[model samples]
Target: MVKPANKPQRLSLSSLKADFSSAVSRRRLVYLLCTFFVIYALCYQWQFLVSLGLGPDNIHHMTVGLIPAVGAVVLSLALYWRHLCIASVVPTALIAVSWIVTGPYLSYITLIQQNTVYLNNMYDIYVGLYLFAILFCLNMAARQFLNRKISAAIMTAVQFAAFFIIALQWVYFALYHSCITTSGALLIFQTGPAETLEYFHSLGVGRIVFIALFVALLIGGLLFANYTQKTLPRTPVYRKILPLLSLLIIFPSVGALGEEIFPQAFPIRTFIDTHDYMERSALYAENHDGKFAALQAVQLNPSESPNTVVVVIGESETRTLMHAFNPNHVENTPWLTSMKEDSDFTLFSNAYSCVWYTVPVLERALTEANFYNNKEFNSSISILDMAKKAGYKTYWFSNQGSIGVADTPITLVAKTADVSEWVDQELKQSTMDGALLQFLQRVDPNEKNFVVLHLMGSHIEYRNRYPKEFQVFNDGTVNQQADFDNTVLYTDWVLSQIFEYAKENLNLDAMIYFSDHGSDPDKGRQPDDISFKVLRIPMFCYLSEGYQARNPEVVEAVKQNKDKFFTNDLAYEFVCGILNMQSPNYDPTYSIASLQWKMERKDLVTRFGKVSLLEDTEF
Candidate 1:
């Protein structure tokens, strides 16, 4: 490619006008602007509709979700519109804009690139591509019809086929994913591919009905288009405005709004479907007293304390696969195995999470809440309050969804710790640990500290939770085993790094790590399904050298006490044994530290049918 010598070019307003007119004709501009504007408004309103069904920041989530869809639809339409008229460059440029907006970008670079791979993959599920194909054909058909180049019947067939395919995806998603009392099937659909197929296979009558209805809609849309054409108004504006407005208003409202509002009235559906998802959370509050009293031991006891206590709340960690719990499995817990041996640690062979999700488990464990249904407990006194009462500084950190819920406990935890950090999904995973480390550094060395770190851990779509470098499966073969192994390894590495920080930086007395609940390893159940794996978690304590020396008895007690423990026992056991605090809710029967009742057996089962090896006998 040789560079030509600079050629003088004439510059004039007339030349610019001619170029602009050629690039974008007035008729095309009207159609494009009308289509895009209508689409934008409908999508924006649909976003709001979807948010209405959800709690708290439903608006924020729906907004993030709509970004890709809206961009893709607008761009796809523009591309088709230009391609229909045989205008090349302008359509291509519009497509490029859509791709860049929806795709990944390097923050530091000016080289604007789009992720075609992502778009290509999305074509199958997204309805926008189908819509583009339909409209392009329709536009072509309309042009031909006006020019007398094609028969009405042939054009009608194309319109009908396009309408059917495009409409089906939305209908399917709505019928299946809508959060309504009647559409629990949507839960099955949204879960993933296997579940959706399975549900389809099982639906004998429903499948037939859906097929029939789909055909009806297809025939209806085609007839409507054909009838409108025969009665073609003299004004093009009527043709332009009617179909666009109808689609813009109907598709999103019926799809998004209907799906969200469907389940709003159902209390059971809304209540149990939460981060705190134990079936009978309210019962614990009903039957139990002194919900916040158990923290007395952890807060009041001077012998167990030197400086800091970190309560790292994990999500969905199970003991069956944890190498520490299952010594037979070498890879199950390679990191924890090394950590336990390297650091002077005490491992409880039997420890179970009381509830499965973060909110209920954390709220119940930290606060004076007995159960998950007890919304009043969200504002109640908690372990943070106990630490505040004990004059110890407290801090809470998390990497979870629900920014509103994240702040609830953190506010209380901050009142006690003098400093707290609540990290949500907004921050990058790599940046989170650094932010926490800085918070730890900023705290005064003179004050006793209570720091809590909540992690996403091995949650579903496990691949996304961890960085790629930690992914051990090289063949691109993904399954439950690979996902589990990768998650365990990444989490183990994270734990080790945090432990290293504890070792080198803070003069910590003890670092206790436990999960909120366990997840099903079978991959046969829902993510929220209660199983042994869901309750079983890696619960252990790492005692710093400085604190161990000062609290010899506490260390001895930890060394000796190796029985099964339920998280419900934490407030009682840790408080009585470590913090040396006293409370009436500190029942000897439920307390892990109560030697007198250590022989008693109890059935540690949650309302969601999750049971674990807990207690000496059924309680």
Candidate 2:
């Protein structure tokens, strides 16, 4: 025994090599590399992921990133590593492509705008992993019925289709500086062939060439992968059934959670929403006559004197940033600031929008429907309807889109006017709000008129909302707040132009201006992350000498209520009071121009009546 122990076996070079090789085989090494690449590529847009608390500052990044990676690695280790590795490529590539296309905008939203709502959720990464698993299952399922050639072709087609959607989103963002939304998708149906061609032409040759090259590269890569990759052996029956079950049941169940958890599916979700919106619009249009028939019975007692009333709707103009509203801010609204001293002007200090978004806010503001009234929006009579019934020549001049697919809910109200005009007929052009002046000039203001001018004021992509001449806040550099300030300045100039024109050219009796909604450019206007700045809109009324003389009590009432809490949903009633058009539906309690008008800070609710402004401490 002693003699045997003297020759104790040592680890030889061959045995050591075998042990090391067992620990990390070539396949396992490749798998590890693939997993690393995916995690790295996904997190390359650091601001997006980091905002979700999945960065170096925390351990969330490691936990979240490793879960999906470990899951994929384990599946590969248990099954065919080659098949799993190949399947992972498609989703990884798609993620990379999506990041490349949307990275700048995501960065802008998170870093520049300080809005983390766009891509800051950890659910985004989960969505990507779910998509990866789906692609893997699809690959496995395709192998069961189709030959290698057919399966490869199908997979490549799927890849191409997903890539096409990404390309379309890129094109949309390039044109609008925003992603394709449900409203935006509906806008495509509203576009004619000429407008579509014009849009593409506007993209110019450089962008067109770049898009073509991108498509070519994508096709070439997919083709190379299809031709060069070897087919895996047929799996057992249970494996085939498992993939089918995952594809048909598990993947769809996860996808059904909707866009909040899976924003990567926005394209498909947008299309579905657009379809539903179109259907609703069509139904509303078909029932338009019946919906308004009740308005015919409601008589409007008009004033004896001929008058002109102007309603100017501003977009995303937050009083928190306007000098006229916030004295501590920059003097961006010089005209409004100057108007503050005018006896004719009455600036409302505590005005809030009914909702934080344009469409919903405008829907309530333009119609008799309101949060407290519990009136159905579709059945509610619009200001245009009231004006028309009162024998006033109503006109709607908007710089925004008119019709999309069918008449949008807003467009339905606009169409009720005797004359409706839009600056951008195609809905793709980024014309200045000043373009609306031409339409104003065409109006015969000598007649008793009810005019509504919809300005594209202070919307997103604030830089595009104004010309270079209005870029007074910036010094040839990118500054989101500066750009927004410039928009505010341009909007002030626009308001002055409109007021001067109406005063000089038209028999302007009374003018009212209020924004459909406000915005928190730093935090975004999403309902989930709303702030008081996103609801605190600027509102004011201008009375002509003629109007003040005829309606002295109304003017006094408006001036007295300037500091009272007001919501734009009561705009319909207020406009009626200004017009001196009395009707059974008119409620003096809600009209800011009436002495009976009353609202308390605690009673005010915004964000479509979900959040109380008084409780929103963020103000």
Q: Top lDDT: which candidate number? A: 2
User: What's the TM-score of every candidate structure?
Assistant: 0.53, 0.71
- Residue pair clashes in candidate 2: none
lDDT (10s digit) by residue, model 1, range 501-602:
765666667777777677664452353544555666667777767666666666676666655555542442453344434454343444444443343325
Best by TM-score: 2
Q: Please, what are the lDDT tens digits per residue for candidate 2 over residues 383-463?
A: 887777777899998876554332267777887788887765523334688888887777786678889998878876566
- The C-alpha lDDT values of all candidates are 0.49, 0.69
Worst 10 residues of 2 by lDDT: 110-119
Q: What is the lDDT of residue 246 in candidate 1?
A: 37
